[model samples]
Target: MTDYVSTTPGLFPLPDWAKEDLSDLKGHQKGDLIGGDEDGEIAAAYEEARGEVIDRQREAGIDRIAEGQLRWDDMLAHPLAVHDAVETRGIVRYYDNNNFYREPVVSGDLDFSGDVASELEAASDRVEEGLQAVLPGPYSLADLATDEHYGDEAEFLAAIADFLAGEAEAFPDHETLFLLEPSLVESPPEDGEDERASEAIDEVASATDSEVVVQPYWGALEEKVYAHLLDADVDAVGFDFVSDREDNVYNLQEYGAPGSISLGLADGQNTLVEEPETIRERVEWIDDQLPVSAFETVYLTTNTETFYLPYAKFEAKLEALGEAAELAEVKAA
Candidate 1:
């Protein structure tokens, strides 16, 4: 009875009205220097935008609703970017995509300042249940940053893991946390890093009771990396079925998967929307390959963030996912 479908974990594309309103208000665009809204005018606009994202997810029947990351500067660097000890430097291409993010330069000791907790708390006020949080995982955060303090890769990674753990501890109660760790796929770790990566992930997972899903996108991890990922204490691992699905399926068949898995059935980057029945068929195909008892719950989601797509396509994909989840659930029954 794997019957869960969730909003993709990251920034949802800003609506047209939001863009115009934000521009008129001189609001900071994501990846910009996140500014303070002293007069509460800019904050009001962001709140309204966040509310719309939540309402759309609810209408789409998403099981776990995200705050929509309306205030996020970017996924990987945001937490560190806001830290008092860190400085935002030149922009770098994010993974293999055209998108870019400010390189967070670590100048002093990294500390948690309830950066994401405020967003989660505000969203909690809007939705009575199923609210979720999104953050970059330690591995990716450390990998992407420019470390002027630690001076060592492993030490830097460990510090980041601990820093994020501190932030996770302060989060208000929520249903799920999507820890985006695309580095595992973009640049596989060197030998022995896998063990450290698992330990790092466990440190964060131990902080909160909410179910954590370590979602890697753009591609799948290699066998060794995937094996080590399974050793983590996280609740589930998300795979990008939209990109390099064969390798991901091979990893699952060879090493097996956790009882809970998030499958990316919808194409997040493409404009050609998938039909609900098409997505339902993809779920059925996955079930055929893996035993029924292989999973207690399977979460259907996008292979990547919907931020890349137009708002109309993004909403359509979400609606399709919700409908497909129902269809898949009925088939299992």
Candidate 2:
């Protein structure tokens, strides 16, 4: 029988203690002229900062931990460590205009010159054990990319998907699972846009061997989107149960294919903690319709990224979550 596993939404902000070093590195990576310290010093600080967050996660009893993304210059830059041609500096947003992301598209080819293996390895070592390395999905990348980048959007999407597939497969054995976050899934297109976007997503899902997860938060998934996912050959699908309505759960039960689901029970983006019994009750309700065995695992997580909250909030939220889990255990007893 497959064992149940748990995880959380990716990304954590740098703590105030580590802010200066993190900002220095960010400025250096972005080619900004910030006078503070040497790159080597900042690098050492980053390793320490990353370790601190990982330790906090372990203390919280989180099964899988991320390096709190302290090592990343930016969210997109995180993947740059693995793929080189895709320069973090290459991704420039057109912030002055409303169509900011519509800036000219850079090359979509795979660049593996700066493999993230070393960074991931270092992160693994710092955590005192192994943990899943997170990356954004190709579909989200393509959608988030500027239209100026390509003559053909479909072609670009396909190529990006292939590139991600290669990166996902190259990680060391310590990371048995890789998370491809497609946060853009929350913003469904008007009409024709949806079909084009779905095809791009299909390509990425087909490329990886690891358990591919499609996660959308802050909104409910549409029927067509759910149908598309049900047919995809992926390992699991994650939904924001904390934000999704009763109808959303009903739709999932009726249309979602029999597979593992990572349940987003806690609010990672906030300081408010949830009662584990409340979460258990929700899981039990879902279990009544779908056999427990149908799921490979039902992970509890925050609806969105936890880093958006402050460190104190994050700790408080974790404390609440720990209480909830304990309550669930007592009730189970």
Candidate 3:
């Protein structure tokens, strides 16, 4: 029988201390943490250091451990690395204005430069276990880039979709591509806005054979978008539970039915440890509605990104999430 898998929410803000800890690892003793023209020794060391973090997460029983995006300066930088066509400037501090866990920003065009592909392959090779490469969703990236690059957001979004699809196509061997769309649940778009964005995302979804999971966070998902997502080629949809728990549960029932779901039950952005019982209860409710078999795969996740948290806080959150999963297995038994 296929066992039920418990995975934590993706994206944890990584503090300098965590970066330091990663640096101490053998393969990453000399690598750069935030990119730039750092020495090759620093780059290799830094990549290996991130692999250490992934190992820790797997040891904690996480089904899938993101590289913690430790290599990135910010979420936007991740896309910037792959798509070099756009000139990325730091404007409109993402965290300062938006209350996000970290600072991210607007960019120019979709540049699929293939900068990250090699690093991803290298990192994947370093890790003793399987790892996922997280990238911001094209729609969310387009929204962030709206005012900065193009006046026509729809056209820009379409370009981003094409860019992301190319990035996905570049990596054929990764187990899954965790495409994060924390902004997808933001303000409901105007009349046809939702449809336009959905079409763009569909292209990305269709471009790859690897599993594509659409993960939206920080806000409640609009019913229309949720409805449209159900019809996409996505393998699974992810939701944030620490913040918009109730609405997400409803969305899961109404729209996530019959689809694989990665439940975001941990707070990746905050330091507070989530209560295990709370997580178990939420899983039980979903389990009751969708047969455990239909539930297929219920992965645990943090609310947003965790790269901003201090090491103590990040470790606490990870530990707490692991506890919650342990409690879930006990209850399921």
Candidate 4:
């Protein structure tokens, strides 16, 4: 049986064809793409794009695949930013990167509007292998958005958590649910916030039968934050081994890794192609550093979204990751 799994955190780069189709819809409000005259055309493009992404992952021998999230123009904030109850505000810097996303401002009562669920359902129809669904974690969503309706921060966070839970419950076919939580690393929880954050994550995780992986990329998690994450009601925890390998290793050695851990070995932002041998060597090093049986299942993936790189480079990374996983499997055997 395969003890290790290979997958991505989702959000692949849009193919050229899809980009061309969406060109006309650029600058228009996200809601327009949902039900406007061009909606059918856009949906068809997304379907074609999903098929292409699935083909690439299958060709590269990826064990688990994602829906590619071709329609998520606002990155991880799409589920909330595109909702009818939320209004898109001015552009804001996305975490420490050069990329930006329109800020989501809560204008009315938050509820599940089915935008994300519809995307997942469409993509699921195209994928043949185990499908993984990706979404922004509640803590990260709350941090990225501006709350206008709910006056209290805690109340707003709880509401977002509930909304995410509803979304997760809608997708019962997903094999894995990746909750991307970059805010935990970008803005570490203060004092008592750790418990609150854990509870929020648990709220979302509890609603899904699929395995939940709380993946925080960009950098290593603070010691306190990592401790809190270990207590979260998720199946796996993903760490950014590419951006901050030293810190990640230190944390694993000192505090110990979760029973199920995903290591982001591929760098998603850079255009430089990595050698399969080099990636295999890094995986072996990580395996050697950790205590025996520290992790039950080790998932291999990119540290962040692959949308930052061009399609060619992204494909190369996928091939490299697959080759590395094969090598690691052979070594283990």
Candidate 5:
């Protein structure tokens, strides 16, 4: 018998109540609240919305729950863009997606203000257990940002890593911490750069007692990059099975994954959700191909953030994943 778990992305489509609240205000943006935010109404709205999503995850029989990143305009760049040390510049395209986020230009050294930790704290108050925190991986954050503070490339990467490490240290107790690193695929590291990226990830991993999952999406990483990721000390590494399954499978077969690996079986970008049986079959097939003990824990997860999808579709996809994981476990037993 195999052990599996189902988890969705941190960024999700806003709930109707939260949407209504935001729209009622004239100057409201993603995180900006309407009505002048005098009484922290928008902040409260995010918490209430987070509670609604937590309930949705429970209703769908999902395992770990997230706070939905409702306050974040974009998961990767929003924290830095809002941080005091960085200045928000023009919006930049998020990877190859149609969505864009305000770019954070680094003009000074980074200061960790427990921004992510505060999100987890709010989420912890809502859910009793199995809470997961997701954040932008150091490499991806650095890659996406405009760094003018550190002249040397390695210095910049290290500074970003240390900054994120501070953020991880302050996080409340949680089940899992997902570090999303889409830049590994968007701006694949140059020769010998993957190792440095891995080091940066490890720096963050070391700060948390919770299992840290380094997930690179949009596409499979290059073979060498994948190897470096596997060697990293994180508890697990994740792959995007939706976009380029063939290349991902080849990497897993060629290099063999670590003891714990996450599989992005659901397509987050699309509106159509697959049947449970189809997802079950895909999981079983991949499991059979991996070497014995290749994975002790396989996380069935979203290929990317579900912020692009409608709320109903996102909930349906989560329901399917929970059912699919159960089916696969039963079949393996």
Candidate 6:
């Protein structure tokens, strides 16, 4: 029997109060508000927002909850943007979405800055259930930024993998860690690069006792890229069924599912709320496509970040996901 759990990809929509608090810091760069007098104010807002998000997730019966990533104004690139070693360059479009993030320029040796770890620690104290921490995968982070210090791409990736590994080592209390890798689907690694990327990912995953899930969204990964990831040391790999359901399902049929799989059932970018039964049916369909015992546990989640949705719609999506998980569990029993 496969246990079904519900979680989001993090970067949830900010609540009204947090938004208002950020309004004054408009012209300031991403993460600039985290110092001096503004620091305490902003931190308070984040705490309130995090509590609200966790409370909502609990109310919806979600098994794993994130810190809402309220400080990630620059999205996944935030961890790097906030680091003193990395310089923020011009704005870049985030994947294919209308959203944009400050491009992180590697100016010096990558190092653990303790920003994310501190936030995770504060959030950990607020939540009762297992808290999940989110980060950009090494390959994806390397792809997103330009390197000025590291002469070679592989060197830069390895440095990033090490930095991320150090961050993971700092947070031994987190139950799950999600490494988002949209670049894998958008720009598949070149021939020999796949092995290097996988090794870097393994390095980060090995540093954590928490269950690490590498979730690549936007679209289905190429056959070769998908195959390489299965060999990585991560606990589970998430596929975006919302963007390209047929192709993703076909990939599973061809390559076989991983030991643990996260099936993205909710469309995070859209405003329309999917019915709970509809999501359950989709999960059931995917389960039918996989061989029995192929996956030990299946996670139900949004295809991408819920920050793209309005607060109300994001809440609705969470409710739908929770309901679908319950439905799947009852049917499996």
Best by lDDT: 6
Better of 3 and 6 by lDDT: 6
Tens-digit lDDT string for candidate 2 (1-333): 334444565677666677765565565332232222237877787678778777777777666676565544434334532343442334354222211121224454554432445556677776655476666666566555543344576667666666666665565544334354444445555455556555655565555445556666666767776675556566666777777756457767788653677767777765666665676676666666664446655555676667557777776555555555444445444
Q: Whole-model Cα lDDT per candidate?
A: 0.82, 0.57, 0.64, 0.82, 0.82, 0.84
lDDT of 3 at 206: 80
User: Judged by TM-score relative to the true structure, which candidate is superior, 3 or 4?
Assistant: 4
Model 4: lowest-lDDT 10 consecutive positions: 29-38
Off by over 4 Å in 4: 25-38
Model 1 misplaced regions, further than 4 Å: 27-39
Best by TM-score: 1
Cα miss at 228, model 3 (Å)?
1.5
lDDT (Cα) of model 5: 0.82
Cα misplacement distance, residue 37 of candidate 4 (Å): 9.3
Considering summed lDDT, which 10 consecutive residues are worst modelled in model 3? Answer: 95-104
Q: How many residue pairs clash in each candidate?
A: 1, 3, 21, 0, 0, 0
TM-score of each: 0.95, 0.78, 0.82, 0.94, 0.95, 0.95
Candidate 3 wrongly placed segments (more than 4 Å): 1-3, 8-10, 15-37, 81-83, 95-111, 146-151, 256-258, 275-277, 286-293
Kindly list the per-residue Cα lDDT of model 5 for residues 75-95, writing each as its tens digit: 578668777788787767778
lDDT of 1 by residue, 1-333 (tens): 455555576678877788777776775554354533324777887888889988998999888898887766555677887788888878788788877777889999987778788888889998888888888888988889989999998899999999999998998889889888889889888789987987898898888899899999889898899999899988889989888778988888898877789888898889899998998888777777775336877888888887778888988988998888887787777
Per residue, candidate 6 scores C-alpha lDDT tens digits across 149-184 of 999999999999999888888873888899999999
List model 4 lDDT by residue over 209-258, tens digit each. Answer: 88889999889999888888778889888889888988888888888755
Q: Is 4 or 6 the stronger prediction by TM-score?
A: 6
Candidate 3 lDDT? 0.64
